[model samples]
Target: MSTETSVTPSLDRAMCAELDAADPLASFRDRFALPEGVIYLDGNSLGALPKDTAAHVQRVITEEWGDGLIRSWNDAGWFAKPVALGDRLAPLIGAAPGEVVLGDSTSASLFQTAVAAVRLRPGRRVVVSERGNFPTDLYMLEAVQELLGGGEPLERRLIHDDGPTLDDVLDDDVAVVVLTHVDYRTGRMRDLAEVTRQVQAVGALMLWDLCHSVGAVPVDLNAAGADFAIGCTYKYLNGGPGAPSFIWVAERHHAAARPALTGWHGHARPFDFELGYAPAEGITRFRVGTPQLLSVAALEASLDIWSEVDLDAIREKSLRLTELFISLVDARLAPWGIGVASPRQSARRGSQVALRVDDGFAVMQALIERGVIGDFRAPDLMRFGFAPLYVSHTDVWDAVANLEDILSTEVWREARFARRGAVT
Candidate 1:
């Protein structure tokens, strides 16, 4: 934010330009509607707006909904979009066809999958999860435990993160284990297959909350033998705000796990108007209510962008971006009392990086004022995301360059910066 100051900078813009030129994913930056002179490094929290998404939603609004009216559900293929979009997104996470579907938010999907997972193992009374997991997950598990066991409650075992793996936590008493693949605060990643194996060894079902890992990193749900997973669309997926979330269940679990929300759409014969409710065949049974057409249209358009993208290229660029950011921070801001909170090793980290600093909320505010947008968490942590599709090497360089001046001049500690807002 204080880049145009008295201090002479060392990190040159020319070197950053050269790096962007050679980057294979450089051309894809034009796909998003990025503003002039802004470096959007917060894509891991909320993704940049896709260029094509607006037009796609408009077509659905004017032609499909406005013109077709009630018939659009069948005629315009609106009802089938959730499944189609799920099938399209399945390959991105290494999931097979007919195993994934779209609807609701990540919180609701977590509740749905978790409820069914616990029910499948009827005899087991313990539900295991981490205290450091996303807050909604822990809350949902608590609710699921109460609802499932009726008057007799199931125990929700919360394992604190003293070390990596839950050696003593995974036992025969556990019925379901919920975990977030990539941690939100530190960006620490867990080994999916190894954890899955441990959960299964004790005959417990594994449910992964992929909120931070889905599109920004590699997640092979099927290859790793994942039982269930749920993730959001507004972040790395580049869907618009409040985009519908996705749910994936292994083909084997469809018959055994029941849908928690028994709405009309999930009924086998909705039009038949039967007196009793019947679950739809296969994955369709997970569909709870009428499909969210507008949000689905925006997400479907975003998925179209993914069809041309190679995840390998995206991942490679992502690592480079994060590496560059971390190196720059260590070189320039280390002496200023800033500390890296994220995993140092490339293989063990997510697409985002976090830094520990005093007055982190104000520092982020100062950075945002300069158009280098990032986010801040509670206590003292500043987070920056590197979404490969749009962010370039030069953008990363410019962000650090601005940060260097901000820290050196103590610009972040200004009285105006102390002001807080609702969202931050």
Candidate 2:
């Protein structure tokens, strides 16, 4: 509970073994395809591959596509994957059946839902958000506003004070309040329940960008009274890169809420070729296009593994791993000018911890060279993500040891490491 800085002993293999023995999800680590001699701490960016994804994708490609051809869409159950996968993912995020649907990128889903929210609240012009939200969320909102420009152009109210409270901005004129449940840079979390209540107090809709918080933190969207939500599959879900994203609309919105992107797939009678667009009942109306079978299959494979594990357990282990990393790094690396940028309070933090150092990029490059794989953000933040399913406690200890060695020897000063890479 102490926010006051203090140091703990360096992480050791013995401590790791004890933690691993106590971990309920320890056996689940074998389900991933982690590289040998490397400690992966970038699950917040792209998750490590699930072992089943290869075979699942192969079956979809060879049998479903090669054999079944266009007929596979119906025979192989490809048409239902979006809603089916949503049902599978519902329990992890505390959403009920028929409330969530999968499709499109996170940005596209946000645009669709934001437009729907505006339509639901007539005559509202303002959309509340925070400045530090992920760039795509902000950009998508701007694009939507531009596309629908009348006197009702969407306006953004960015929060930018020390621990700024959003209560004041929840006015009657605000149509939607879009926010990232967990901050991408600082790993800070917002109280979803309280924020939803505040936004609804003035008859405004709450749209949560759950890209960072979905699998890493415990979220009860239904319990929190969340109106709409969207998130990607790649991060803590262990789905592969560029995986399709999901959108959830409360059941209350199903009958009345109108989808902005009214594609043929979402029409109630697609085969009838109706001239008018009558939206499909329930969450199926959120589907904007044909499902990506390969990506959805990969997500299914990963979610299969997740289905056997408890989300609450994942959250607990995530906190333990992050806390251990912070304690160890602060004790050993603080003398070299590393400052923890993430919130010290566990409740306010996500699965990742951000550390600030003068040469963060080069330091990360050195760590990568030494078999530890964390990422470097802009300016000076070194981001380390702890994936509870695949990352072991021993990996955390090894990563810290490599960091300590790099800082002690100043190996990051090498000219080769100082040069920026394409991906970083």
Candidate 3:
């Protein structure tokens, strides 16, 4: 499949419609249950609902839960849903069947994997990560540091765009390096294989937080020789809100790796009710407790949609969509000082792009009001995600046209748009 379609960067809606018509993945858009009169570009934050999700959940509830009841754990395959779903999700990230398993949340999974990674190299005292990583990873690491630290907490070394690069901080003392595969705010992607080699060369394990990269980009944990990885399903995966996160441990680490959460579900003989904790063999060791089954059912439904699509095709459409958006923004919105915050290079970026503007929050609110739903990060970046399965080229054109009008009219300066929400 060609990642690039020959489309001219013209300020014409008809051209975009042509691109949409030619898009091989265009039919997949109908699989989603999107709202009418809404252009959803927020898949980086939360994915749009799959059309099959509600019916699938209803079936599970009525047939499995309502009818089967407790027997559903055995007959309905509830006990193995995490591992089963993990196997289904493996191909998207280039992982094997037994290497991935679902966990509670991205934060909990990070803490679980990070602790195991730190334990792997006992004497090493430092953990390296980016300063701009999603706050939850850093917050979870703080807890990991305190718990593992005998007298004093482990030293946390953070790399930044300004100074103290990864090469500067990496050394023999570093036990593990935890980094996001794609930056959430800026959408800057890292070379997974090269970074893994660099971290391992210093005798440190690489634990990738794939929260932004998993469904948005192609990831190969084994191919990169990465030690651990964790990601959420609600984003590009289109799982419902609060869906379970997943953890991937390299096959090499399965035997010796010891996660911090030693729930009975992860016990070697979970049904035996063993007094002492014994971690289950393989990825099952990562399971903490009884999973939120309804959420898992929702995720399982989403996975059906994923099973049909091709990752390379998704990547191709993703690049095209982002490229179009960037080109349009540069050509039309430049006079208003709107800047692309993400990497201009397609290879160095994920599926999303960030636009830098002074009044990003208010502008995003205005855009949301106009039915162009993207999101804002902190002080200035307006983040837009392009899920190739649903987001069309014409949608990109309409988004930019709407944005151009908003900036030109100064509608973003209204008092109502300025009223901040607790979530944003």
TM-score, every prediction: 0.96, 0.96, 0.98
Ranking by TM-score: 3, 2, 1
**Worst lDDT window (10 residues) for model 3?**
1-10
Provide the global lDDT of candidate 1 against the true structure.
0.86
Candidate 1 C-alpha lDDT tens digits along 217-244: 8789888898999999899998888999
Could you give me the TM-score of model 1 versus the true structure? 0.96
Candidate 1's clash total is 0
Estimate, for each residue in 68-97, the C-alpha lDDT of model 3 and write its tens digit: 999999999999999999999998888999
Question: What CA RMSD would candidate 1 show?
Answer: 4.2
> Candidate 2 on 171-283: residue-level lDDT in tens?
88888899999888889888899989988999999999898887898899999998999999899898898899999999998888887899988889878988999899998
lDDT of each: 0.86, 0.87, 0.92
Which one wins on lDDT? 3
lDDT of 2: 0.87
